[model samples]
Each structure stands twice: as structure tokens, then as C-alpha cells.
Target: MTFWALLILTALLIAAFLGYAMFRGRKNREPAAAYDLRVYREQLAGVDRDLARGVVSEADAERVRTEISRRILAADAQMQAQTDQDGPPLWANVVAISVVAAVLVGGGFWMYRQMGAAGLPDQPLELRKEMAEALRADRPSQAQVEADLPAAPQPQLDESYAALLEQLRETVSARPDDLQGHILLAQHEANAGNFRAAYAAQQRVIELSGDAAPADAYSHLAEMMILSANGYVSPEAEEALKQALQRDPRHGPANYYLGQMMVQVGRPDIGYRIWIDALRVAPPGAPWVEAIYAQLDDLAFRAGVFNPPNIPAPSGPSREDIDAAAALTPEERQEMIQGMVNQLSDRLATEGGPVEDWAQLIAALGVLGEGQRAIDIMKEAVDIFAGDTEALELLDAAAFQAGIAQ
Candidate 1:
């Protein structure tokens, strides 16, 4: 039945029940009718005997008999009035009980009709089958589901990268003497976003290559060091850079990175010279040459030095202008390059030429709360090179200038 229908029926049933109770109370009369004549006579006789024996006065005896009669008559009249009222028949009571039972059963069934068999506790076997079907909908048949489920869903990237790093580690461990393996492992670690492991792996490469060979090993080591030093650099990684540099002074990456590290640790002049030397030895169009040159520019900028001084502009067409006074000679390129080097040297000699120049500028600017400028200069360097010494030196200088270093 609808909710309203059930409510109306319940109210009617309650009213009927109350009416029946009231009816039964009226019909099942107490023994309030007149007392039996035999009992009354006996009681009156006993009272009379008492009066005759002088235990009571005739007036008192009469009063007691009269009072008792009055009470008995009042009780009998009340009982007879009660017996005259209406009451439920036995059949009516039985029907009410059947009606209540039917209401309860029908109401329960109506509510249960809204529920599905999926919710039935006795149908667990069916529920399992449904769940298996759901899984099959999303997964390929060939893919195996584990007998034991995971506590929660795992990130695919997290799992994939973690596995890659693990494989790289195993490869490096198995081939301890393979410098290339270490380099590959380091790159793998870097790709997997594990900078610390990458740094360590690069350090291993430097160690395997030793002092004389593998010019790029030091450079890679320096890259790792710079990355590590940016809160990314670890002490162990720093040690690795040191080892790489120890293997070769002219190792381009090593010299550049170590020089920057040195400046970060408060040796800007050495850092500047190292960067300059890196630029000098680096071949044009070499893999890392542009990066080295950018670092030099960055260093000059941070030192508050702009362009180099006293290099006459090229006099003729690009090729001829770069040549020497001897027209037939191939000295133009050499002269132009020398002029460029001289220009770099002159700029280095100015107020903000080298590490010391940057240090002074950073300090002076810091005192004036020009930290943004200092930071700007450093950022410019970072923009030009991935891991340059000049950039590192400026980072250190800025930090020191800002009173970050103790």
C-alpha cells in the first residue's frame, strides 16, 4: 500500500483496538450486583446475635446493619450498569489479529520489492561472478590478475621509473669497469628523475676514466656537481666532482664546474680563470663549446662587466675583416680570435671582471637591497648554460652577498 493508505489503515486499527478494549472493560463486569440473599442473611444474623448478647446497643446494631446494606446495593447497581455496555465478540478479536498479521507481512514485502538479488546475502556466488565480469570488461584476457590484490592503486609512472632505475643500478654493478655503463646508468638515473643517483653514477664514470683520458667524463661529473650543489648537490657528489677534476685539469666540464664550485665556496678569481681557460681550449662547434662561451658571458654579466674592451670592429667583409695585416696569409681568423680573447681579458680586468668583480658587485648591491639585480644576473647565466662555472660562482656570490652563507 502507499504510505498514506498504510497510515490511514493503522489509525483505523488503533481506533478499533481502543474501542474494543473499552467495550471489553464494560462487558466483563466485576461482582458489583446485589450480594447473594443467603450471604446477606448470614451477615445480618451475626450482627443480631452480637446485639442480643449486650455486646452492642440496639440503636448501634441497627445503624451497622443499615450501613452494610447500603454499601452492598451501591456496588451491585454499578456492576449491573457495567454489564449492560457493548463489548467485542470473540470472532471480532480473531479477525483483528489476522488483519494485523497481514498488514505486517504485506508492508515488509513491499519494502523488499525495491531491493535487487545482488544484495541478497545467500547469493554470494552470483555476486562473485558479477565482480569477475566487471574486471574482465577492463582487462585483457591474457593479462593475469594477481591472486592477492594490492592495498591501493599504484602510479604507473612511479612504477615504471622505479623499475628503470633498478635496472640501471644492476647494469652498473655488474660491469664495474665499464665507464660507458656508468655514464649510461647516470643518464638513465637522470632521465628517471633521480638526481642523487645520477650524480653518483656520473662520479663513478669520472673515477673509471681516471686522469688522462675521456675528456667528457669530467664535464659530465661537473654537470652532476652543479645540479647537486643547487641543493641537488650532495657531499658524496661533491667528492665525486673533486675526483673527476683530479683526473684532469684541462677536462673542460671538470675545470668549468670545479671553478664554479670553488667560487661558490669563496674563490671567484680561480673560478673566473678556470672558465676563461675552458673557453680558450674549447673548439668552435664542439659539442659543449657554445655552452662554455655562454658561461663566460654569464660570468662577465654577474661581475658587473659587460663587453670586452679595445677590439677594433671587423674592417671588411666577415671573412676578410677577421684576417691579419698580411692579406695573403691565413692570419685573419687568428687575429680576430686573439682580439676576442684580448677583449675578454680586458673586461675581466675591469671593476667586475672575474669572481672578485661579481663578489664585490653582489655585496654592494646586497647592502643596497638590490638582491633582485644580483639574482637576475645569476639567472641570466643559468639561462645560457646547463652547468657553467660562472653561473655557479654568481650563485655562490649572490648567496654570500645576501648573507645566506654563515
Candidate 2:
């Protein structure tokens, strides 16, 4: 109900109460005048009979009858006045009812029109449900996103990464005899952030090399495995590298890799010991000397127990060391050193480090008295090297020695 409707209803209720009060109030306002008409008539008739029977004087009867008639007339006039006092007007009642009805209907219609004009919509369950669903559907899972990815052309980096992986796989599979291929595959996998896969590939190389020439393969595989292990090298991998070290106590790569692994695993003392061993075994002009120095500095910083002085700047091969190596006769030294170098280089080719691994394989073949195989390996290396002068010269010399050239 509107304000106007409430006001009108209140007015109607008040009027009705007032009317009832008037009706009730009027009940006891006038006193009761017991003018019993039947008693008056009977008493008058008895007086007349007495007058007729000469039982009473005429004057007395006449006076009594006149007094009784006066009382009756007064009573009738008072009753008429009482009946006409203070009744509610019919016109007033009709007007009040009209006003109440008008207020109720008019207020209701006006409110309805105002609300409609303002576009006050009703609450919709369907719209609320749809909004909830839309909010929930906006977010998708990783698997869902991957599934919805379009067949669009890949970016250059992605394409190159995929091609590199495919080439590595093909090279590994096609050239099982080529240890260098497996090594390259492992290196590429490492570069691509697949450390586990790289470690697995190196492990295969170690397995293939067997006991005869496992030093370099063990070194490479141990390096990758330790790197993959992060700061906690597995006991299994650690033991494998130690076994390799025992076989060739002066194996430079194995010692260096193991030292690095030890440092990573929070064994700085052991790492330092292994690094010292590495320095002693590695040649004067070894290629990895600078890398070893950096590792030592890192381990020392992490240990925090005692600060060690920086390793002295690396120097070239000492004159004394060169002179001592040169003192031996060329033929005898070549024959002896060639055997060691061939074994080491063949291991390097299998473990996959340098691009010149194919040439190393050729060198090893020639040293092992397989001249024809050496010639073929050299040709393959030349084909791979293409415009490289060193590879061309090496290939020509090997071919001449094998009697396969003019």
C-alpha cells in the first residue's frame, strides 16, 4: 500500500470508530421515564367508573385525568428529540469511502508506472547461471590449452630445436660404429636442456667402450650424470667414476669431472683433493686447465671454512717438460705415444666432445693397422668437414698411406 492509501485507510477506520462511539454513547445519555401507558389507561378507567357510580367527586377525577395526559405528551416529545441527536451523515460516509478507494488505486498505478519507466527488471535465474558459467569457463588447464593449440606453423626457434633433435637421433641410429655420432647427440641433448637424456646417451657410450678403452667414455658420462644430479650425486654414478679413475689413475678428464661432482654435492674437502689430483695428472698445456681453476674457486667460496688463495694464472707448456718429452727418439716415442693417443682419441670420439672426433677415429684405425678402414674413415671426415684445409690434408695423407690415392 502507498502513503496516500495508508492515510485514507486510517481515516476510514477512525470514522467507523467514531460512529460506533456515538451509537454507544447515545444509549445511556437520557434518564428512563417509566410512563406506563397500560397502567395510566387502567387507572383512568377506574376513576371514570368511580365517577359514574357516584363514588368520587367530579372535580377530583377531572384534575387527575388532565395531569396523566400532560405527562404522556411530554414523554412523547422527549423521545422524538432523543431519536434525532448526533447521527453520522450518509453523504460523509460515501465521501470517505470514495477517497479511500481513489487513494489506493491511484497510488498503486503511479508506483507501477514509475518502476516500469526506470527499467527495474525482475531477477533472472538464467542470466545469473550463464554469468557464473562464463567466469568459470574462462580459465583452462595446461592439458586443455595444449589440446586446443592450432596447427599453425611453428616459430624458427621451435623448428630448429626439433630439427636438431631429429638429426641427433638419425645420426645416432645410422652410425652405430661412429662413436662421435652418439657423443654429438648427447651434447646436443644437453644443450637443449635435456640433461637426463644427455646422461643416458653418455652411459651408452661407456657401456659400448667396454673395459679396454672406457676411460674417456666414463669421464664424459660421469660429468653429465653429476651435472644432472645437481648437488647430490648418486652413489652409483659416483662409484662408476671412481672405478674409471682406479683403472687410469692419471686420467685427467675423469679426475676433473669427479672433482666438480664432489664440489656440487657439498664435499668441498674431497673436491679440493680430487682437483689437486687432476692438476697433477693433466698435461701442462691441457685445454681444460682454466675451467678447472674456475671450479676450484667456486668450491672454495662455497666451503666457507678457510679461504684459499687464487690459483696462479695458467702458463704455457714449460721448456723442461717439452725438452724431456722431446729427448726420446722420434720413431720410438711416436710408436709408444701413438698407442696411448690412439686409445684416448678413440674414447673421445665415442664419448662425443670435439668436432674433430671423426678424424680421431681415422687416426686410431691407422694406429691399429687397419689402413683401409683408416682411409675410409678419413674420407668420411673430409666429406663432413667439406672446405676445412686441415681435414683435407689429413684425408689426402691417410689415403696416400693406404695406397688408395694417385
Candidate 3:
């Protein structure tokens, strides 16, 4: 129904309900003077009975009888005056009631209307979905997503580094199917400022890893592409980043570039958010740490973002933990991971955290090969962030990492 029609109907209904109550009250009401006189007469009869039973002194009885008689005479006189004057005037009562009814009904409707949509038509779920889809359609296309990251820092390539790169390349060429060989070649090439070579090796690594490849493979590919192009996030590079995210949403290299992509697309808030999350969860000695911070510091300065001179850095796997884990067997590693996951899961279940935190925990479980635990955590995360698109996207990334989703 239209707003005005509904409002009017509600007001009328309230008015009718109140009017009926008023009418019922009037129908059941007795004449006030008659009722009062009857009550007084009963009191006088009680006093007479008390005096006959000698329950009162004669003097007290006389005084009580006199007071009662006086009150009865006054009531009888008032009743006579009321009869001669006719009944009470009703228009005053009606006018008072009408004003009260109008104030109550109108004021109530006005207050209720203030809290609601008021004049807007109610939108059904289907229409809202269409509108959201249209909005997404208007956003930048896949090709337009750019990283716009700063150029990778370069230092003079020492002779030893050059020799090492050539040696790594020869070793990789000799064993084309060796995944670790390709990965090492890609890393050394990128370190020696041969991003093109790095890109080629990263591609080979992905090829060797095949369909079962994790996000790191694609992430490395994306990074090399950007570095090769002097840090321009091209369409191909963006696609590589997409694939990396498809497998692991919070993959360090991929997220770092993608967040820069958001910045390039004029979404500083998203970039800042993702970068902050990456910074928070990054390993203590991870190579991407400085680069991520460099862009963030610049972005914060440009935007006048107020931050402390030194924000305390996030803690991650300590050296001791790694050393201890390295000493343990694979089965022992599984047990440790399960213990950590249990603690994290219990904490998150009792005291919830942000979307990315949940994603990180799920990713950790997936890395540990705890498929069931990862799935359970994913379900809980989805329930916690239900209907939140950004939250759901983060969760989907975690799920993919966990193999809970394709």
C-alpha cells in the first residue's frame, strides 16, 4: 500500500479502538451523586447498629450520628440540585477525548514514520540484487585493474650473483620437470634484477606444478611480470594475480600487488585495508615486507593519514618455533599444527575477530592439510560474515586455500 493510505488506515484504526473504549466506559458509568449518597446511608446504618450493641459511648454515638446525619443531608441536597440541573454536559468530555485521541493517534503515527523508510517504496530482494549487479557491471573491467606499484629497488649486480644466476639457469634447463629447481632459478633471477628471466622460470615452475599448483606459483609469476615491466601491473600480470588469489586470497605477493592495483584504480581505502592486513600477518623475515611498507608509508603520507611514529609490528612464527619444528618429523609437525589450530579456533569461537583474521586461520589449517578443520572454520566464518560481500570474498580466498572451494 502507498504510504499515505497506510498511515491514514493505521490512524483511523487507533481512533476507532479508543472511541469504542470511551463509549463502553460511558455505558457502564453510574451517576456519581447517587452512588455517593448510597455509600453514606450504609455508613449511617452501621453506626446505628453499633450504638444498639453498646459498642460506643453515648456521647461518642451522639457525635457520630450527628456527623453522619449532616453528611447525608448534604448529599441529598446535592442530588436534588443535580436532578434539577439535569445531567452533566457531554460536549466538554467529547472535545477533551477527541483532542486526546487526535494527539495520541497522530503523534504515534508521526513518531513511527520517523523511524522507517517513510516515503520510499519497499524493495524486494530480487530488485536489490539486480541493482547490485548493475553497480558491479559499471566498475572497471578486468583489463583496467592496474597495480601502479613503485619500481622494484635495484642494486648493482655483483659478479658472484651473475655467475650464480647462469649456474641456476643451466641446472633448471637440465631438469625441466624439477619444481624446486625452477623455483630457485626464478628467485635468484629476480634477486639478480633479471625479472624477464625470473618470469620465464616462474612460468616453468607453474607448468611443472601443473593443476595442483598452489597460489604461490601464480603469485611469483605475477610478481615477476610486474618487476619485468618496471612495476607496471599489466593485464596479464593482473590475471596472474587473479589466479594467485583464486588459489590463496591472502598470498603475500599477490595481495601486495592487488592492493596496489586497487590504489591505482582510485580505491585507496581498499588498498590501505589490504596492505594493513598483509602487514599484520606477514612473516617476520619475509622478502615482501619492506616493499609493502614502502608503498604504504608513501600512501599514508600523501593522504595525511595520522599514524604513530612507530606502530608496533605484528609478531609471527619466531625463529625458535621454526627451529623446533624443523627438528620434528612430518607427523610431529601435523600434531603441532593441530594444536595451534585448536587454540586459534577456540579463541576465535569465543572472541571473534575481523574477516582477514578468520581467513588467515583457515589458510593456516589448509596448509597443515587439516581439510576437515579448514572446512569447519570456513563454515563458521561464512556464518559470522554472512551477506558481507567483501568479507565473503576474503572467506572464499581462505576456502580456496583450504581446498574447501575450487
Show how many residue pairs clash in every candidate, following the order shown: 10, 1, 0
Model 1 worst lDDT run, 10 consecutive residues: 140-149
> Which has the greatest TM-score?
3
Error of 1 at 330 (Å): 42
List lDDT for all candidates, in order. 0.54, 0.60, 0.73
Backbone clash total for model 1 is 10
Q: Which stretches of candidate 3 lie over 4 Å from their true place?
A: 1-164, 283-406
Tens digit of per-residue lDDT, candidate 2, span 316-392: 65668568779979887778667765675566556643334454455456545576667666655666667876556
Q: In model 2, which runs have C-alpha deviations exceeding 4 angstroms?
A: 1-161, 170-181, 261-267, 285-287, 295-312, 316-406
lDDT of 1: 0.54
Show where candidate 1 strays beyond 4 Å.
Answer: 1-165, 170-181, 203-215, 231-247, 292-298, 301-406
Q: Indicate whether candidate 1 or candidate 3 has the larger lDDT.
A: 3
Candidate that would win on lDDT: 3
Give one digit per residue, the lDDT tens place, for model 3 in 247-355.
Answer: 7666788888987766665555567777777777675545577677657777775445777245445455666987999999989988888888788788899998888
- Angstrom error at residue 121, model 3: 34
Q: Model 1, 1-406: lDDT tens per residue? A: 3654665576567656765775566566445354454466677888999998999999999998997787667666676676443455656766776676566556655655655332345646457556544543443211121222233333245777678768868877998987656766776666555555676777676566555333345445546544534423333444556665554455555665666554444334456667666666653333344455556656665544565433222222344443534464557655654565445434644533444344444444444445566565445434544466644544453444243322
Q: Which stretch of 10 consecutive residues in model 3 shows the poorest summed lDDT?
A: 140-149
